[model samples]
Target chain A: MDYGWLMFCILLASWLGVELIAKIPSQLHTPLMSGTNAISGITLIGALVALAHTHEPLTEFLGYLGVFFSIINVFGGYWVTDRMLKMFNNKNNRK
Target chain B: MNTDIFYVISSILLIHGIKLLGKTATARKGNFISAFGMALAVAATLWQHPPQNILLTLTVALTGAYIGLLMAIKVQMTAMPEMVALFNGFGGMASVAVAIIEGIKLNYIPAIYYDTLIYFSLFTICLTLVVGGITFSGSLVAYGKLSRKLPTSSINFRGQEWVDVILFVLLLLSAYMWIFTHSVWSFYMLIALSFVGGCVFVLHIGGGDMPVIISLLNSLSGVAACAAGLILFNKVLIVAGCLVGTSGLILTLIMCKAMNRPVKKVLLGGFASISKNKQKSTRGTYKPISTEDAYYILEAAQTVAIVPGYGLAVAQAQHAVKDLAQKLTDNGADVFYAIHPVAGRMPGHMNILLAEADVDYDQMTELEPSNARFGNTDVAIVVGANDVVNPAAVENPDSPLYGMPILEVFNAKTVFVLKRGQGTGFSGLENELFFKDNVRMIYGDAKATLTQLSAEFKE
Candidate 1:
């Protein structure tokens, strides 16, 4: 896609984001934040591309750091969110 | 399926995943769907564009994933705010790494190619670097505050606002230099300035106002990612980043609204100074309640409202609180939790802490409704909470916390405040509720007080 097209997508997605997040209740705000944190780790793809296309020492090091950070962000964010969400279930049977 | 089509599918999953997260029944499934989408996106990227040095990439990625999962497992429920802040810092730094990698790649292209590309690459590269740096450092500051590594007080000095302005102006000038002359030093300067700018911006906000700053920084992290996506023209990154950016902004706005602060002032460190505004306008002194007397009073109360704050989690009293609530329930008292929007360090913090103790979400109530019901409540049992239940926020006009929404615990027939000592809250605002005639302060560690109160009920 061209630069202009990418900008358009960014704008559209932002509009989508506002609409998507506005409906969430205040009680679920924490999980919503954590869940989106994981989604931002989609930058892992960008990092992978950097590592794949470069052979320079600086690029390799930076690319590796990017991969590492994004990977943890993805796994940690999602898992932590899941763990938190697991606690929110209604357990009427509990004595 | 076309490899390109996989990106489309994953994007759909992400959008739908967030949509589901708003609902309690579907929230867990939403997390699962989002993770599944992320996995699919990663797999598609790996399959379509296999890395040249797969060994090194896998090693780093796997190691990161292991650490992330381990933290997710090991982190205490009460420490969720700090963990989330730390993760946000890593995500922010990741964007910086992505931007730097792209910037290096751009340096390889001929100078004429920069003009042909509309100077767009330079702008996105520079923007990504500054914003990413800001998010990383700002998030780290947030982490420090949440974890108590740094004092939770806002560190304000003379000319702090001027310093922020100067840094920002210099940052813009460097960005211009980087874009026009492609100077390497200008690029590095941008990085340094943004990181400093972030720390300075966040450092100026008061500890009580940290939840707002953290939310705003979380938004910045997403914007940085979006800029990185713009540099690479990646669809999935753009969608995910944009989604996170807007959502974080909305969350920040919601927090500001909840606290009755404007977005501009919150960012400008409007509430930074640790104000010592302790006005005792109410009649009568704070009367301490013995656990035995508290139990007698509680046992006879038919309706109870429990107002909890960050201190509840700090004292790890959630389980004790639940036990007391159960005891109250069995004693023919209807017990419910009253949650203030900005109750804990992060949004919904108290909910997570209480949920960890198996408290059903149904048992919890939000501010306005709980406020409306407190007038009818026989007793408002405030546990380890100060600022949120402070009557001064609404009663006294001169207070720093004035106009901020609070739990009107004084409206109840009897108010039992579980606190540690005579000190003020995080904002240093002396609780006006404590001095009210109906209010009885129970000074001690919250968990011990709750357990003892529960034991009294058992007798």
Candidate 2:
């Protein structure tokens, strides 16, 4: 795989995603930040891949820790965002 | 099986979910949809690469999830900012761990080095460690301040900017050595310096700048995750990381615009020095009002707007504020909250505070609309908020708050400020609104004063 092309794509996509975020109103910034923090938790996939490649004892230990921390970020982030978003009173939830 | 199909599907869902979050009505559903996407991605990954010790992996994942759930359930609304900060820290630390693991593997398993790929992989790994470590420690410091475990005031020293530059250069040097020499010691050194750099980077930013700091660290974590994905050649990870990183960067920029400062000025060192002229002379004294008198004014008012700030958090006055709003509503008075972009130390702090109080969501207004309403408002109640409503933001160009948009509460027919004393706000600038002829200051604890005012409505 050509690393240069892949990195360029990642940078471009990320820039576009941020442009989307800029369109959101400031009132929604808190939830958006929290929501995106949850999105960053996608690193759990990386940790899983690391664990799968575990060969040596030290490598295995690092992989385990990676998975552990990423799990916390992922599960914790989503749940917390859900909790916060639930409080956003709007017309749909007013009743 | 390529399993790439699952990656595509998950990425689409994640994007859709994030897009949905732009509106209040759909935000909650968006959160759930994103979570589902996350789960799908994780499940697919685990399915593709089933670990030899399934039990051990399961145990670790479950334990982590359980802890996260408990914390999310237990934390109060006011602590949400710090909780978000800590979560970002966790994400950064996780990426750092994964990057290190991948780096070790890359070094040990002499893989086919295609032109520049080896160099790119090594560079990304180093970048991940530096950025991830910084995000982790910086978020911790932010959490400490938000939670009152550490000083909320930005701690600055002589030659602080130079110190930061020196640390950053040293960090780059260490990372370079680790990459070229493959020396484990240099790698450890890089990690240590990265952590320290993160702390120093944020240490001098005052409490008022926390929302920006939090958002920036959130983005840094995203950058770290993306770098880790690059090192590991994980497409999904790379996509997700970019989404998060860019969004966070935009949020930081938004915050910087709200503060009327350049992003570079904020990152180099923030409003710590804005208060250096603390001995600035006061222009006029403020008039104090009793609760009964304030209530009478509020009662006679046809429209009222409440502006809350970090002071409300300190006084835990959100509930009382809500009750007061309800009473005003009961009296046939129009009531709404004016929320500044940077209000309450965190984004949407005022909204969540009011939400927790079960206030009608429609009653909350942003700065622009709220300012428009202020001209028609009969009474503007400043509740433990100072800087956001300070008229100096517009009237005095020399003021630090100048050019920053404010609530325009000073335009109201009558303004009543609820405070404990004649203290300046978090930014250390005295509010010109306080000394205005039409304004009245009600001195007391915010919660207690608000409770008293609410009782006056009952009378």
Candidate 3:
């Protein structure tokens, strides 16, 4: 299997995903983006695998970057999500 | 330079950050934990051989940082959800890009060890692309509806469900084919179908359920990243993705449970529609009060508790309500805010809105604590809120929200409700409290009515 072919498939899928999401209206973007961020946060798994396998200096370096970004994606994503969820708490005791 | 030291530091930051998020009082500290963790991770990465392409890395990091900072500073609390969706989309996009780069590089490695690694990378890349794409598009649509750029009702096109199902099946089939046959076309089709499925799924869902849907999508994105991380054999991505996915699933479930509905029911899109039917009721006989008369009563009251709702959000009356509360306090009246757990469109909506008005947090109490004292309250002021205070929840066993806890504002000595009209609440139920003998309907915009009440209190 040619590496370029695999890479093309990955790139194509990613571009499509981003473009489709971008086309959604602005109002839904937060939850939608938050959901996708959770998906992106899954990159943590990739970072872990990279850590386990990589011995080469270049591979180790990329693995480190992956780990850092993945952590940010997970932490920042959940924080924003929690904040958004808090927006629904209303204090109106009308009954 | 021990790599173990970096890992230990990062792990500690993550743990501390999570702890900070556990308590309401330490929420700000939680934000700091997140910042600290990211900084530590970045420092560790930089220390592991300075970036060869310093300009590229710095440029991307700076660009993302700038945009994020701008949004944090400029975005109103109301628009926070949409901003979250955008950021999530960016994260998924990033993962997909990384997976692709890794897939390309895998070709350069020897074919003997290629089967496992290349296949895993391919699978992850495709999964991330499809799921990420769908989440991105769906979130935008949700944002539009929430911001009123589009209507909040279900957009039911003919055969919408059938189309979505077909697309979903096709997406699965494509994934299957890609794994079995290793065909590029299968991968492309899978991506296309998944993207289309995302759009269709979100479009069919009504605005009321966007929060749950968004949370679910967030989980999906997390799983996608987890898969990618596994493909790349990156420990951090794996851990981070798993944590996010688990947390997201839990949050989504909690949101659904709070509504007292099943996840399937929420996803199916009929709840809000059923609510629409209940909105229309035979007109009941009830005396309404003018803003002036209500203001007079409020002015004479010794204790006032303000209950806010979606109406306040619509009227943008948080500031006015705060002002009213202050005036009541100044006039020797005890004032408190009673917050129901699920009052606004989402959880904690009222707190954020009121906080923006500089309302003292100490004066605000959760429903459980305040309800115990409602009978002693001289006047319970309800501003643009409904449902959560509905007496039907207590008396009607068949009621959708029956057995659900509510703020007993009706138990107060006098209840003054400020509303524009007798509109149904988010749950689509007519509030019996509106017609209670002790209740007075003060009709108008929340802000204006509160202003009137505040002026009278001052006099």
Candidate-wise lDDT, in order: 0.85, 0.84, 0.62
Candidate closest to the true structure, highest lDDT: 1
The sequence of per-residue lDDT tens digits that candidate 2 reaches over residues B251-293 is 8888888888788877755566767866454489899999999
Scored by lDDT, model 3 comes in at: 0.62
Please give the TM-score that candidate 1 achieves against the real structure: 0.96
Q: Model 3: runs farther than 4 Å from truth?
A: A1-95, B1-5, B46-52, B100-114, B217-221, B276-282, B285-287, B397-399, B427-429
Of the two candidates 1 and 2, the one with more favorable DockQ, higher being better, is 1
Worst 10 residues of 2 chain B by lDDT: B106-115
DockQ of each: 0.81, 0.76, 0.10
Instruction: Give the per-residue lDDT of model 1 (tens digit) for A1-95.
Output: 67688868888999999998886788898889888888878888888866777878998899899999988989999999999888876553353
The TM-score of candidate 2 is 0.96
Q: Which portions of model 1 show Cα errors greater than 4 Å?
A: A90-95, B108-112, B116-118, B274-284
Can you give the lDDT of residue B126 in candidate 2?
Answer: 91
> Which regions of candidate 2 are displaced past 4 Å?
A89-91, B106-115
The order by descending lDDT is 1, 2, 3
TM-score of 3: 0.77
Instruction: List, residue by residue over B240-318, the lDDT tens digit for candidate 3.
Output: 4554555556666656765566888777775555664554443465568887787777778887888887677778888
